[model samples]
Target chain A: MIDVRKALFGYSEWRWIFFFNKESWLSRKSKNGWVHKKRHSGKSGMALLLGPLFRSQNAPDPPPPPPTPPPELVWEDEV
Target chain B: MNRQLNEINLLRAIACIAVVVTHSITNYAKTYEPALFDQDKFITYFRFALLWATPVFVMISEVLISKNYPNGVRKGFLLKRVKYILVPYILIGLLKSYMHSEGQWSVFFQRSWEIVVLGHWHGFFVLVIFQFYILHILLGRFLQKSHPLPPILISFVLSFTYLYIHAGNKEYRVFIEQVYPFWDRTIFIGWLFYFVVAFYIGQNYERVLIFFTKHFYIPLITAVVSYVMMMNRVMDRVFVSVKSDRYDMLIFALSVFILALVLLRMIKKPNHTLIKLSHFSFFIYLTHQLTLPYLSNLTQTVANTFWSHVVILTFLGLATSIGWAMLFYESRLTKLFTGRIKALDQLAR
Candidate 1:
């Protein structure tokens, strides 16, 4: 095992990745990502909010950049 | 140790699982036409899945209310109401609206009432909790005083009545109609039944404990069968028109029984981690939706295939949920937010 207590002295990229951009890199980038994955993850109220109704694939792709909902023509009703 | 388990609490967790399935199935239906289960199944059978999910919440409310103010219902303490129920409800709704800001600021605000009051129509869960609070003292007295049969029979009749009406009434509200329709307490057609059921079931401490410990598989089988029957709309004509209230209580009974059993058994050796996880279950439900969109945005860049995306999302979902639970359990935030009320504080279990 790379004695992490000793590895703390490492410099440059190690320090940068270690300190600055930590969680995203570690969770998404570094190989140990899976082991040290974020505990609170990709859940939200909207999922529950819109849930038990719209069943997506276990985890769907990032929803194709979320195509904007068509603009409602509120004024058209008055006409 | 075998007996002390809160079966109702266990069923609450079962409700959590059902919510997971319901959401999963709902997403599938919205995106793809044919779902794992038909739309109708959700109301008739699966909707019952939600029955326990939130009414267990009602029981929780009654228990908490009775514990806190045993005398009479507080007239209208805005601050008190806001502290627990209102604050969480509004804050969560606002967070949902902000995250899901589907349109312009005006549009979101226009619908904020919808979200705040209705919560994707699932808001009925909160309303039901409020209903329980309003009825707590009375309901508690009723449960204490009356034999279980009257409430049970009343709830049964009311549920059947709702099922009959919902079926006969052809007009669709879109909002009230789930893919499959039925008389559901969550949507409040026959909610009185479920509310009373929760109250009654909650009152019998020994029966609750025994029920959970005794017949575990019956519920498991019932849930599985209910899922199948409702998913297929097999009982529609006989039970309800669009969907059926056919065997909802049976399903709930099974779900609750099984859940109580599981919770009792599992809780025997609940370590710190499990306790912590259980502790955060509510927050998990409350906040998970907030976290998902952010993760979706972040991961869209890195994740390649649909499969990989889902894996990441699932992993992240579990991780973030646990993380949040851990944070709350370990942090000062729980205390800070909860205030000085200590005894009725939600247990990790």
Candidate 2:
């Protein structure tokens, strides 16, 4: 029931992990090794793609996240 | 919390109360409202209101806790979090198992796993709390301690993504159908916006409070209007969007905001009892549904005079919920079970 596969960057437990303290930021991991995951496809940023729970097979199965709430932007354009 | 921000805890308690009722009234497993005068219709309006409670709680959580943490620390913070989360997680889980499992040793054993894996959200919100702790630590790092744009963007993008997914798949559609369905948690992407909003307000506590202060009447009027229309069957009469959780978020945010402002303005010094209410918010959340079977049975029994039953059921459910919460919290033995009763007792005093 478990797939041990981890996605390329954001989904990796280690990748994109941040230590925000200035000290940690200046450390070898944060200062030298950090790179923002970018989109080559037209899809949204990498954060949306990085759910490790969704990926895990043997891991405790979490219910899929709630459907996103819609916009309240009452644009002058959209009737 | 600053002087103005103190009452926000009251908002948290209020949100928790709304959630208590939300779960109480809407268990498809149990229907506790009376039938006449359209009980189903009343629940629809309630469905809309309940949609916002947990999210509002999450949003408030983000406000109070997310940005407050310093990013650079790792193991220490996570460990501290585990102490709060896991102790209760393990304890109440065992407690639920013991209470629910008379002789079903196998079932009792199964609940331990559920607690770890988050089987019943009705019984515990610790799962969501765990998710938020991780998000707060991780995203809190990327958030430049001041900008509001990130959450703004996160909110819109995730909303569109869900809509797109909603278009293609019925399975996805069914998952997010209800506001707080245990099977349909959308926290990962959906709550980012809320977290950001919470963080922004937490940071600019005064600005948001002031802005909310000035515009209080506007949202208040609109929410009342929407709620009245919802109850009157004026809006959405043509197409009832039971699964339309998005609007629930929109309206709930509005309601919570307006409610927050109104409560803030009215209470110069909140009753000490009200302050006491905030401490049991989590416990109250855990037990709101405990009275469901009693209320639901009572509802079905009084189905003849539906409106009167509705009134009685509402009052009884509310009282039973608060009473159960107080009893659980005040129990001397609860300290031994939750492990933090000692700690919480110290804080409460």
Candidate 3:
């Protein structure tokens, strides 16, 4: 016998998860900041894997400033 | 700021009435065998002619969205829809599940979840509309900047091809079912052409109005001819079902949409009654199914003939739906489900 519950609800949820994951991944990859940096950083694997499931909470924070920045640039950025 | 489009209000009234009529016929038809009624063929023709109803509703939504947000929507767009539209959708789904649950908790929860997620109900149009909302956010700007003709043609082909494959090919249909069950109607591919076409029309409202006004006969003629062809296909069993998503209906629906705009333009004075009906349309759409069965039972007592039953049911459905919606609209707390949000009203003007 067919599992009616899975046929009705499970299939659509799985498709939705797949769609959102693809969309968020592509969008994040195309953007130019922490999202891109986070994807390339060594800790990105688990974050990428769990991104779709906990998109809001697991959103990558802003990347820190480069340590070797010029003093003027650092002052302007601080200002 | 957008000017008040009185024509959109009238069009909303017309589409809302057509939807109620179509559902009324469906309910009455379900009560008896098709062969039992002598007017079954005519009823079929009428129902098929009104296939434009739901598609027009979808087009109206895209038109407003594209026109209102030509530069693209801000961040709060989807959030507003979730509050006004999705909340009511889920509330109604739970209400429906409760009605049919027969006091069983498991059945209630399961059915409620199915209705919420799978859209296994008459109000599945909400899910389809939600898809268009996301589509607008994603593609509306690109579509606005590009030439309309190419995208229109491409979307038409995509819509027609998808419908043909889903309806004509059983093997693919079954395969699709495995991957995305209960998505034959809720998916965007079957209705993409309407969105693309309506997006352009909404962006170029004045030019489109002038063109349609100058050549009113064009859509009128095409609407009649395509409708007749649709009826012929149905009679010949070329369409195995009486669904609105048939490939043949794409042309018919588009023509009726243009024709409606032309006809509504001829009137000078604003129709207050139609405007009110338009205001209550979304709420009516949500709650009409709940009231229709009870109204059908009441109408059956007085009307012996099939046509009389259907006509009476249609009127009662519209009236009671509007009446109940008005009662709900009177309160601040209950107004969320009525689709008459103050923000939306302000935006409309």
Candidate 4:
């Protein structure tokens, strides 16, 4: 039996979970309650954690849409 | 519609002149012995100083592309470039190959293949530019969204590393040679820094103009310092050759680029002469080498001194190239060879 809180959160801060995840321990809720699964995950777990950092931080806002056109008036020449 | 970048035209004109001068110096070196020319040090230093020319051309190309198509290029972009740039490149490559092959069909075909495919001659910049065109298409949205500083820094490192490895590592050189002989200049990695910096400048044109105006001395001092460092490296024998692809040349080129921007920004009104020269620059660049040999030979009899010969060669080279370019540009049939129809319309007015 493993303490899921201690395994996931660790003795340090929540941010330290990334460093502690090397054992590939993932906790899931089973019928019995919280069950720790020793899932052999790839680097994708770490990558998913850090992916947002590499994304564009300050993307420019999109341009505003053009104003709507006014209704056309009938002319005497057309009539 | 984008505002007219007259400063870019001025920069183009300056770059064109620098290129012509560099080629003139090279011609002098080729034709005459070192002992024959008393100004050997000056010529060498000047050549080193003008290493920024080709990179500046690359930067200008990027600046225009980024500025014009900020969102992304619409349909017919590749088609337009192929028609204007690739067509002329092939036509000129064939012409050059024909001239050099001496009427031998086999030799002509081989040379044509080398020139067009391998980028054998001075027109290798066309290959680099085409690579950037593709790169822009792929990375345009990402580059637009992200801040420019990181990309510029990253590209500089990549460019410098590639150049350094190519210059220092024998194995790497051999490997590159096995892959492509002209990889040093022809590869986009070697020139990526300039493109990234140009993208930033093009996107923030007014801001860059204002910044340069406020800090005009920054680029000027940097240019001087980098030039001195380059010359020192040459004197110390730290640098084997004075090619534009050196790691040190990247800094020097960037500084000179900024300096040129600051200096050229002072023109109150558009200089028609400079604009025309800039307009004719591409054609001039393509045809100048063809006329340079003849000009050098012709000037050799007239000018006895080193400076006189160089001056004569440069002047005649520019004159004849511009003359031919003007003729081709003005005429309807030959105007396609100039790679720009819009310039003809501008010139007409």
Candidate 5:
């Protein structure tokens, strides 16, 4: 009952789905504007550092925005 | 202690070592010398060979959990998981975070939260295992009275589609990365099939074992072919950080099946070494991430050649992980986190 062929190569029909980029999804949905949100800490920052190595081969996006300091830290420490 | 469970222990032992060796080769080689990782043929094949480690661990987890809760989810089982898995996870996460910051109180809480959520180093595997545990309970209830035919078929379609789409889909990957960026593999969908398949197999343990044993060549051939295909794909690509693709999962599941069949037949008696190592596997899993980088640094400083350096690092990393686990195993605190009175009871229980 194992469909080896399908298991190995069944996503051909939806291959076009792969091409529908998320950036386009973002742009089309946001009629007015969208903010470039900042990741202050946690795994997002780490991924921003290491994402290039494991990113999809088909992606055309630029590097992620630099992480902004947490608002609390910024407020307390800013000169 | 039962003969029936010996094979699972052996599998765990092998899988843990594979994980350590794979991490040592892939991470260290990439960090210290990228070209060597790229150019070296042995390292590539070695990584391919050992790539099944994490998936196999996942499968074993599903199998054991399914066995315990054959009918459906149990409150006791979930509570035990909280004790054995989540508690140690927090403890180990905090410990690693504190160490990473060298006891700096400022960053300790933030770092600990990161470590616990995203996992410190390879601790993401623990999170993946936890996710699978949760999925198993939820799915088991819906799947309680079904004939098991529908679920299997559904998992097949869902799992394969998931793999194919994720592997190919660029936008979805980016979206997922942006949204659930806490160690992407920890997502249950990526490993849905492995856990589901293992759950089914574990439920029908005897029949499946016999089937695999009788027609072993089918799986053997499947694994070999799949591995060859994956390796070919990896070689074709310039970037070599290939974790488990879908093909890799299929091959590894088959391989684990084949390995279980062979081990069950070949070894009637318990191998004390494997059992002992298996007892400490989770302990080692927690501590190995911390130990590997230090060992990698040491090996880089001490060893002369690439081959020698990698070999030293791999074995030393394995030994140090086991040693750390052994220290914890013998210590009085074994009962506190592990929930086991004696060391070997951790495996046997």
Candidate 6:
């Protein structure tokens, strides 16, 4: 009988998980298995305001540096 | 001492402390409104832990009534209770009305009316209990000697549904605003769940106690869990700018019952401190609100940090309330407020 009551009411404790920020780390299931999302830096201020609600799985790599302009077109010519 | 009665007294004592804790936090919060939702570590956790105070109180009342009148309520029982409960309520209500009202007769009349109907400050609970007591008598006729389980189950469903759909309804919200003196807490339908659950437990004490003892871990876990759940709701409401009523949450109502039982199990023999407080609990309730304004002043001047300020204010308010109650207890004024020369003497039994 006690087991019955526990089974019915005990799940309520799952709510305690909401208190911790540790659980805020997002993970998603993939073809292989669940994968933890790596947090990206330099989020816009508005994104910061939204906090854990808005999580991105992957950070966009830094834009490739513009080509070196063919060695500055024989540098002396440009100068 | 009867072990069960001692347990009841201890429950009362704990509930009284929780009430003081809740009011202390909130009274300060009224001035330091930011502290309650400030994400302050102490205030947030402390507030959630004691949030069950009011429901615990209502449950205790139901338990007492059910324990004493399990054979079904009678006219004599109602009369005795009414004389004790109603007389004190009226006397205190009149006193508050007199103290707070302006010189105008009309103002005095209006204030007195509000006092009786809505109760003077914390005295509103007396009205709630009075209504439930009368209902208990009427319900007894219908229930006869049947087991309390069926009604408990039925009322739980019905009351929770009533609260869920109607508690924060926009139309009634408009109505409450239109009538400024009206208090929504006086509505008995919104609080039926607490009374019903307690009544059932009181009626089936041995069985329920066994169940609680065997599954005590469940309540321990849920108490913490429910606090976290309540904090989430608080955050959600804050985020959305929606204000929820203090005692209207269904989950909160359920958790309080579970927590009250958990607390009851830990208390084997009632401590002297608890028994004394339980005796004077009502007196404390009647006087506590009067201390809030003064404590509000202290909130501004006493301490720099939110935590220290709240801590001092809580102690000061509780001490002052108890102080006044103690003064009244030894004075002739005790009879005026509580219908006895020594209020604690009668209650200690």
Candidate 2, which CAPRI tier? incorrect
Stretches of model 6 off by over 4 angstroms after superposition: A1-79, B35-38, B144-150, B174-182, B238-248, B331-334, B339-343, B346-349
Please give the distance, in angstroms, between residue B1's alpha carbon in candidate 1 and its true position after superposition: 12
Each candidate's iRMS in angstroms? 16.3, 14.9, 31.5, 34.3, 18.0, 34.5
Model 2 lDDT at residue B2: 47
Write down the DockQ of candidate 2: 0.01
For candidate 5, give the lDDT of residue B235: 68
- Against the true structure, what is model 4's DockQ? 0.01
Q: Write the per-residue lDDT of candidate 4 for residues A1-79, one digit (tens) a residue.
A: 8786656554433422454233234322233454333334422344346645432233344578899643221111100
Ranking by lDDT: 3, 4, 5, 6, 2, 1
Model 1 has a clash total of 31
**How accurate locally is residue A13 in candidate 3, as Cα lDDT from 0 to 100?**
31
Which stretches of candidate 2 lie above 4 Å from their native place?
A: A1-79, B27-40, B70-76, B97-102, B111-116, B163-168, B171-182, B221-251, B262-266, B295-333, B336-349
Tens digits of per-residue lDDT for model 3 on B35-84?
42244677777777787888899899888888778888888999989988
Residue B116 of model 2: what lDDT?
A: 40
lDDT per residue for candidate 5 within B136-228, as digits (tens), equals: 767876765677777767766776676666666889778878998685657777777777778877888778777877778777777787777
Error of 1 at B158 (Å): 0.9
What's the candidate order when arranged by decreasing TM-score?
4, 3, 5, 6, 2, 1
What's the true lDDT of residue B136 in model 3?
89
Candidate 1: DockQ? 0.01
Model 6 chain B: ten consecutive residues of lowest lDDT? B238-247
Best by TM-score: 4
lDDT of candidate 3 at residue B145, scale 0 to 100: 79
What's the true lDDT of residue B134 in model 6? 75
Quote the positional error of residue B224 for candidate 2 in Å: 6.1
Model 4 docking tier (incorrect/acceptable/medium/high)? incorrect
